[model samples]
Target: MSTHSRTARSGDRAASALAYGVVGLGLAFLAIPLAITCLMALDARTFLGPLPPPALSLHWFERLASRADILSSLRTSLVLAVLTTILSVSIGTAAAVGLARGDFPGKATLTSAFLSPLIVPPVVIGFGLLLFLSKAGITNGMARLLLGHVIVTVPYCIRTSLASLLGADKRLTEAAMILGATERQAFWSITIPLMKTGIITGAIFAFAISMDDVSISLFLSDPSATTLPVTLVSNMRAAFDLTIAAAAVILMAVTVLLIVVLDRLVGFDNVVGQGLFRS
Candidate 1:
């Protein structure tokens, strides 16, 4: 090879190495805190301290189970997350279908309006929901939480479903209709099947978002209906401890499990890659 070609190839190799190094550092930056929290949870020490304690034990894990408030909050979070996923996926899918297939005059404006929640701050959304719901006499904590979660999660579902539908084979639906299938039949048997991946992806996103939401849940939740994230924040304010770390470890485990399930259902690369390309 010419000296110039060799120089160019060496420069490219160096650039690739630098990019890999940066990525590795980024991953470590995110992972280290989680690892430390897990380690603290396993520490046998009576008090919270640096990781790699004198000994390791599951004492904090046992303590985590005994904490009734934490357990209740966890249950509440799970219920809200499930409800949010179902409501968001169902409503968002229908809205996405309408927005994607319809030829309405204000179609672009409506799409932007639907996705506006994504751009709005969570704290602002929570405060507005609280005020509106309160004025409407909707004081029930779980009900308020459910409404907030659905609102936030719906945007994700709509975006995902729209992306999938945009890339779907429209001719399949037409073929089904020509074969004597009614519009509803064609939708259920043809369009829905094609949109399944997007729906599932949206549901997963909704569930994860609902579970992690604290700013919105904080405004909506009451003592009896507190979510895990809200409870964790309350606990942190009251007193920071290893028991909290234990709870965090549990939450992390659950999140990891969900991600694993998501990967199995629809490879992360496929979900993100397809969305990026479609958009």
Candidate 2:
């Protein structure tokens, strides 16, 4: 190779290394705060000291059991997350399949409209839905919360599902059809199996969003229908205490666990950065 070519390759290597270093640094920077928060949550008296107590103790975790309301809110949040995951995954997967691969009329415009929720601010969406629901005489309860979550989650679901759908082996469906399988049967047996990874990944996001929802839940939540994030917000606002730290730790753990599980099941790396119109 020429000397000029060698220098050019060396320069490219340096640039690539620098880019990777920057990315790694950014990830670690964002992770530190949560790491500290999780550590603090295990402390006996985290809120009393300088964020986390000097020493660690499982006192707060043990104390968590005594707070019945907190327990109830956790249960409620889990139920809500599951419901949101199921609904969002099912509908968004269907929508993604339709929009990404199908040749329907005005497909571009329809996809954009469907994905508008991700672009719009969450608080605005929450309040707008709040007013609309109130006007429609729909009581602000779990159903209201579910509706709001579904709106927010649909974009994620659709985007990821579309990614999987786009990467799918198109010939599988065609081959099935050629073998005398109907379109519906082909989709169910061939397309659906291939799309499972994306759907599960999207469902995980939907579940996490619903569980950790504060903006929508804040407006839509009633006393009985409060989600975990809503409960945490109420507690943080009304009283700053150690139990809140415990709750935060629990929430963070749940988030981490969900991510880990999704990665293991569908390969999280496969589903990330599929662009704005992903599964």
Candidate 3:
């Protein structure tokens, strides 16, 4: 081979090596904390110590099982997340369709209104909702939490769904309608299928965000109805313990399981590729 060709080959190999090294470092940065948390939770020792824990046990998990308050918080978080996901996806999808397909005055303004939550600080949103809901005579704690979560998560759905709609082939829906399919039929059969990738991607993101939210949950949560993240924060204030780590692991596991189930049912790669990574 020529010297120039050999030098170019050497440079390509070095670049590939550097790329792989960077990716490995990025993975390590993300994984190390989670690994530490799991190890700490499993540590047989009651007190926090150096890495590897010296021993391993399920003592923290057992203690976590005995904590009624934490368990109740977990249940509350799950219910709230589900409700938030449903409401946000519905509202956001509808809003996205309208904003994308509708031609009317102040369209840009309306789109901004829907997405305002993303730019606003969570603390501000939470406090504002608290006062507004209180004055509106909506005193139910669960209702308040649900509303707060839906507001925060709806923006993500709108963004994903809108992106999908923008890239979709409108001719297919028109073709269906021309073939004697009613507007609703074309929408449900043609447009919905086209929009599915965006909708599902948005729903997953909405679910995860709702599950992990603490800032809005903090203000909206009552003693009777509080999310797990908020409860964990409160517990940390009162006492720091390994049970917290166990609870965190449980929360992480639940999120992962739900995502896996979704991937199995809907093919997450297809959904994400079509929605977020589409060229």
- Best of the candidates, lDDT: 1
TM-score of each: 0.95, 0.87, 0.88
lDDT measured at residue 61 in model 2 versus the true structure, 0 to 100: 81
Please, what are the lDDT tens digits per residue for candidate 3 over residues 32-73? 999889888999998877778888999899999899998899
Return the top candidate by TM-score: 1
Candidate 2 achieves a global lDDT of: 0.85
Q: How high is the CA lDDT of each candidate model?
A: 0.91, 0.85, 0.88
Model 1: per-residue Cα lDDT at residue 49: 69
Candidate 2 residue runs with Cα over 4 Å from true position: 1-25, 51-54, 273-279
lDDT of 2 by residue, 166-217 (tens): 8876898999999999999998999888888778888888988888888988
Better of 2 and 3 by TM-score: 3
Candidate 2: lDDT of 10? 100
Window of ten residues with lowest summed lDDT in model 2: 270-279
Q: What order do you get sorting by TM-score, best first? A: 1, 3, 2
